[model samples]
Target: MSCLLEVTALCKTYRKQHGLFRQETIKALENISFQLHAGKTLAIVGETGSGKSTLAKVLVGIEQPDQGEIRLAGKVVTMTNYRKYNHVIRYLFQDAERALNPSQKIGDMLTDVLRFSTVLDNLQRQQKVLESLQQVGLMDEHIDFYPHMFSAGQQQRIALARALILDPKLLILDEALTVLDPTLRAQIVNLLLELQQQKGLAYLLISKNLRLVRHISDHCIVMQHGQVVESGPTEQLLTQPQHAHTRKLMGMS
Candidate 1:
């Protein structure tokens, strides 16, 4: 249960042209801070434009924070050294189909990850790919299938397999479960929890689904206007929200 990720005073801003000469500054995230531990899940729940997605992108190195510090396993993470941490922290996007290439077979796609990130030979990479597929409840037969060949749920499983291929300690899920139906979402949640227990994985879930956050997360933070309005243990925060924004999110009067 050691701390695996620490984010402090994270800030991000963007300037957009308003008119021919005027411009507007938008603060996406302001002084955001949090901690996540091994084998735990931390859920960020917010409305659209609340900066949840921005935080995900920053954590995964897709975007740089204007001012902040990110530490993984007590080591500072900067854009310059992000490549060293890429294998230890991975991202799973919401759209599995869009994240995957339709023309590539699942096996080749997975092998490519190992081919670049690892020193394993062809035989070793193939073995690792099969192992990763099995970790997400996929089978050997799925290795030859293209992205279009699977159902929405199965495609997500494949994406999960790819993320776990490198045996990452932290997985940032940017609305990864939002696209699935109730039943499929439940299945993926169970699978994710199982994987966490088995591999001691940590998850940073960016989502708007309150029910999913309550069920799967150990702690929850509610964001509004690009700031955290409330944060606490998941059950406590959900059942007894303190902030007006959080109450509104929960449909409370």
Candidate 2:
């Protein structure tokens, strides 16, 4: 498995104002570094304000890093060139419903990506949409339904379908399974695993759920106050966390 994504010395910050004269510099990420290979899963676990979401945003090009390097498929990724890499990397947010358009039918929503990003004709784009739906275990009939017409799990499947429509090498999942019920979560986990095996997809999972992280991730990184406090193979790190923050996060302290 080749290195699908590499991030090094990544840093991000924000400025906040208090009163009229005082300003605060918030460190959202600091010296973050990691690598993810094709068909592998890497989990980022941290409490709120730990910079997990900021890292995801940076990787997906929603936010730019103040400093650091991001390489996708061995090519440097920057704000100026991120558009060229969009088809190779995709993001799956926690809120599938909110991420989707309520007005557009499923097929239209999926087709829109192809329409704007590729040179596929109408018939070719339709075929690609149908293929994407099938990949996510959706039937062709469901393509005509609106977002509200589907259950939460199905809506998520639709979101996954759209993400997969581009055949991306990496998928950044930011608390993507947090809202689902236990049963649905398990189902989606299984589906995601299947898809990864079939598509050779690399996953960068952001979550606060230790159990979920342990179950799904091959490796794990624990973040606190914008830094990676501890990291290792998932099973080993969960059972034998070295950092105080990691132990506290796992309820081991």
lDDT of 1 by residue, 15-101 (tens): 999789999999999999999999999999988899999999899899999998999999999999887899999999999989999
Q: Local distance difference test, per candidate?
A: 0.93, 0.93
| Candidate 2 structure quality by residue, lDDT tens digits, 7-116 | 99999999999999999999999999999999999999988999999999998899999999999888899899887788988999899999999999998999999988
Model 1: lDDT to the true structure: 0.93
Candidate 2 deviant stretches above 4 angstroms: none
TM-score of 1: 0.98
**C-alpha RMSD of candidate 1:** 0.9
Count of backbone clashes, every candidate in sequence: 0, 0
Question: Could you tell me how far off, in angstroms, the CA of residue 222 lies in candidate 2 after the best superposition?
Answer: 0.4
